[model samples]
Every structure is written in structure tokens, then in C-alpha cells.
Target chain A: MPVSVKNSQVVYDALKELGVGLISALPETWLVHLIRMADDDPDMILVRLAKEEEGVGVSMGAHLAGVKSAMLMQNHGFLASINGIVSGAQLFRIPLLMLISHRGHMGEADPWQTEGGMLTEHVLEALRIPFDHLDHPDTARHKIGEAQTLAHASDRPTALLLCRDLMWEAA
Target chain B: MRRLEALEAIYPRLSDCVVVTIMGAVAAELQSLGHRPGFFYLQHAMGLASSMGLGIALSRPDVPVVVLDGDGSLLMNLGGLTTMARYRPPNLTHLVFDNESLLSVGGFPTATSTGSDLAGVAAAAGIPYSVRVHELPTLTAEFDAALDADELRSIVAKTEAHYEPPAATSGFVTDLGLLENRFQFQRHLASL
Candidate 1:
């Protein structure tokens, strides 16, 4: 199934409304539209990351410069970025707004993504990062806004899981 | 050139630049000289200083962002080099102080000791200007040019593997805590 362009626009519009001037991301199946949206927007700065961990540092720098920024990646990418999240963002008290595509969930078709999908919530809990499920267009904007607010207020990492319900459309 | 001497020579030139230094000796030595609002000692997260500098440079194209990185840290996230090249922010200057050893954690040898060329890697990664310098004069000159020109540049300075013990720092712990440093830096950025 292809990702829903309508849902992608909802998320992208929400980020822009939230004043996110910069975003760092690694390409993922569910994030194709969002990455393209950011790339095509002249006002937005899209940093194509070599690795997800680099996004953590990018967010930190953005905060230091008073720029609102977000990081977009998949579950496995989030897993790869834990070290930077813990030591760089957490230790230094930088606000990180991460929009992670929740891959390998119940309807997952890929075997490789399953392990990371299963571990995603557990690791997020262990890291004490507050997160919300962006599973519906009705509440996604509110959740993302709240997450961004919490991240800046607490000066720590916050995540919004992009569930399949929000990203995918039935064929 | 030694790391401290290189830093000392360049410290005065950094008044207008936002400098991000990797943890341990580089951070300690820079802090020892003095703490400026534009200076950020990125501690604990080893290899991300370059990434941070790239972000800052992209965010604020008005000022130059200099990353004072080390060989070990640079090796840990060499992919950052590729990413930086991809963006190629004109306001960013990456300075890798290649001392050949991990002097912070018991003097372990890094790949640079065995001849891995960081500048070569950066050049191949597509940075417009990348060079390796083994002398203070050349390092300073390249740094000046990088700052003055509106182009993405990177300089890897070969230095002796030397460590400055904590005792030598005399109990200095960056007067401001981590959060305080961020707030101060943001304010400084606003002023600029």
C-alpha cells in the first residue's frame, strides 16, 4: 500500500504551523512524502542525514540558535540514534522533537523491521522520553503540538510515533 | 603543531565565530583559556560536534560555525563528513585536531596513527575546500581563509598526542551547567 499523501500533508502542515524552520531526516518508506514536502518548500531547511544520530546533534544546534527543528526517521533509525539522544540531548538539556515512523508493527510485512518495531516503545520508555501515537488526522496536530511543547518545556527528547493508520491507505 | 598552541593562536580570531569543541582536552583547553558566549563545549556525545556545527551554520548563515573535533571523534562518525559535504553550508568550518591518539581515555591509538587520511576523506566526500595542515602557520592561515570566504571548508591539523590531566585544569567545570550554557549561547546568537 502506498502512504497517504493527505496524511503526509497533515503532518507537514502541522510542523510548519508549529514554526519548524529546519528538519533533519533519513529517507524511509512512510516518510517519502514528508521528505519531499520539506525538500520542495523554499522556506524550510531540510538536512538529509547520513545517519539518524546526526539529527540529534542537528536538533541541539537548532535549539542553541533559537531555531525550531524536528527529526524524522523510522523505528530502526530511532534505535540507531539512542546514544546521541541520551548523551547529547538529555545530558545537555536540548529539546529534540522526533517524528518517528512506527514501522514493523502488527501489520508489518517486513521481517527485519519487526524486531525494531517491538523494541521501539520499550526503549522509548526506558529512555523516559514522553511520546504519543499520531494514528489519526483528527488528533495528530494536537499531539505533535503538545509533544513539541513538552520537549521545549522539559528541555529533553519527545517523540511522536507515525502509526500505519495515519501513514498508509488501503489499496 | 600542538593542539593547545593551535587553539591558543586561533582563540583571538574566534571572537566573531561560534566554536563547538569536542569533549575532553579540546574542550578543557578551550575553557581554560576563557569561556565566551559563542563557545560551546560539546561534552559526552563524542562525534556529533561536527553535526551540531553544521546545523548551526545552516540555521544562522550570518555567522561562521567552527567545529573543533578530534581524530577519534571524527573517526567515530565519519558519515558526518559526508552529510556536511552534502549540505556544504558556506558558514561552516570543520577543524579536526588529529593528535593520532585518544588522549582523553588513557591514550589509546586512533586510526589516524595508522594513516587514515581525514582531509582526503572529506575532500572525496565533496567538500569544496579540504586540506591537512601540520604546522601552526598553515593551520591558522587556512582557518582565516575558511572564515573569510563564503565557502564550505575543512582543515585537519596533525598534532602530537598529548593529554592534559584533570588536575592540570585545576577543578574547572565550565562555570555554567549544561542547560545554562545552552541558554547563554542562544542569547548570544540572538545578539548576533
Candidate 2:
């Protein structure tokens, strides 16, 4: 069974329920659905970043502006953005719930995605940031809510890593 | 040459100016000169001083902002110059100190002077005002003049590619999170 649009919609509904004020997304294959959902929502503030790193900077700046924002970027952007996360986003305690569409993981056809997938855990650890994978419906809603809550309550950023398997299984 | 003169000369005229020195010895030197804590060290982040400075300039256009950029550091985000030009921030000075060598990170050449003229590149990018300096006295005069100018400016100071950098760590905090906060902190920057 191919991952259906419903899965992305399920995640979207959960985020809307969590009160996502702003979302920064790159219109990648898997992320496009969520981007559309976020766009259709009038209350959501969405801004396109020139680069992945700039998105981190914008998120930090917007956080300064007192807006709760999340980043929706391609996994490849993770490479360009890791520095901003470690150097900036994490250090500032600007919490953002990452609605990532996992790329380059085990079944990734592109060679480049493979490298990022292999290093995802190691990279997140290096920054001292905590994250949980969302591949099943049983905990997806709870995990999404908790991540957003943790981002707000603790003032520490949390990541919600979405794997290719989950996207396929549920979508 | 022009950069040191700009630092010394501009401080007297622009009362609301802020400076962000790049990593290595320059940070220690700026610290001794009695500057505020910005994201000054590499551990906090690398090659973001200019970007951070730009954010400040945009937010506080009334106050002057200067980035004490090294040739090597400036090159890493040369594309930023385009954004700088597009934005055209007033009261912002990008003082590029070009020693032609990466003095702090071993004696490797910066390659700043290798292929293109950085000042010219800035001019072409619509910086509105651009100048280069090498001699101390003339550079100082130019610095004073540019600070008083009515438009955005970019200055490239060509110095000895081999001056010994300071060894002490700067008092400046390297926390990007703290610096990006909305509230004003005197500890981070004094009105002086």
C-alpha cells in the first residue's frame, strides 16, 4: 500500500490542532501536501527561505518577533541548516516542531540522500538536540502534540523526524 | 590598513555604531578595545557575523553597524553582498580587512586578492558606496569621511598579510541565541 495523501493530511490536522502559527517549508515531493494545507490555513504564517540556513535564521528572527514558527525543509537542507541549528536555533532556545519528509534513508534512490539519512542521528546528537521518529499513527498525534508543547514549555527545540517508511505506510 | 583606520576613526563620530569582529585574534583585539558581546567565537557559529550584523542594521537602522570581516570569512558568504546591496542598509559598514592571508588559521593565502577585486565586486552589487584603503593616515581620513556619508558604504582595507594576531580570548559571548533575543541587554552592548 502506497503512502496516501491522507497520511500527510493526518499530520496536518494534528499540527493545526496544536496551533502552528508559522511554518517554513520547501516545496519538495512529500512536503508539498503539508505546504498546501498550511497555505490554505489563513492563521498560519508561511515564508519561503532562500536557502535552508536562511530558514533557521528567519525562524530565530521570527521567534524574536514573538511568533511560534516551524521549519518545513527538505532533508538535503538539513546539511545546509545544521550549522544554523547548532550555532543558532538550539542555542537560542527557539523551539520549532520539524515536520520533515525523510529522504536518503534506507530506500532512497538518490545517492546523496543516503549520506544524510545515515548521518541524521549522529548530526542531531552533535547539536545536543533531542528528536523522535513519527512513522506510526498510534503515537503520531501524541508525539506531535508533545513536541510542540515541549518546544513552547521548555524553550528547547524538538524535532519530529518523519521517515520514508511511515510516509509510505500511512500515505 | 583602511580597516584599522576605520575602527579608530569612525568610533569618535558615530555614537550609535556597533562592531562585530570576525573570529581569531581580531576578536581578542576588539574585546580589549572595550566592545560588547556578540556572537564572536567560532564555536557558536562560523561565517555568520555579517549576516547577524545585517539583521541588526535592518532592525535598528538609526544606529550604525559595522562588521569587522576578514578576507577569508567574507569570502565564505560572498553571496551575502548581493543581499546587502538589494537591502541597501543605511548606517551599515562592511569593513573588510584583507591581509591577503589567513593569518589565524595558519599562513595559508586568503585568495581574496587571488581572482577578483572584492571592493569592485561590492560596487557592482549596488552597495551605493565603495572604497579601498591601504595607507594608515589616508585610510583614517577616508574612514572618517565614509562614516559621515549619507549612503551605505563598503570599505576594503588592504594590510600586511602577516601581522601577528592577539592571543587572548575575547570577553564577547559566542551565544547566538542570547544575541538574537528581543530584549536589550546592556551587558551585550553599551550605548558607548
Looking at model 2 chain A, which ten-residue stretch has the lowest summed lDDT?
Answer: A57-66
Return the TM-score for candidate 1, rounded to 2 decimals: 0.97
| Two-chain complex of model 1, DockQ on C-alpha atoms against the true structure | 0.83
Off by over 4 Å in 1: B165-176
Candidate 2 chain B: worst-modelled 10 consecutive residues by lDDT: B179-188
Candidate 1 docking category? Answer: high
Q: What docking grade does candidate 2 earn? A: incorrect
TM-score of chain B of each: 0.94, 0.77
Where does model 2 exceed 4 Å of error? Answer: A1-51, A54-71, A87-99, A105-115, A133-157, A162-171, B2-5, B13-15, B37-44, B58-64, B86-91, B123-129, B135-152, B162-192
For each prediction in turn, the share of the native Cα contacts (below 8 Å between chains A and B) that it retains comes to 0.78, 0.10
Model 2: how far residue A112 lies from native, Å: 5.2
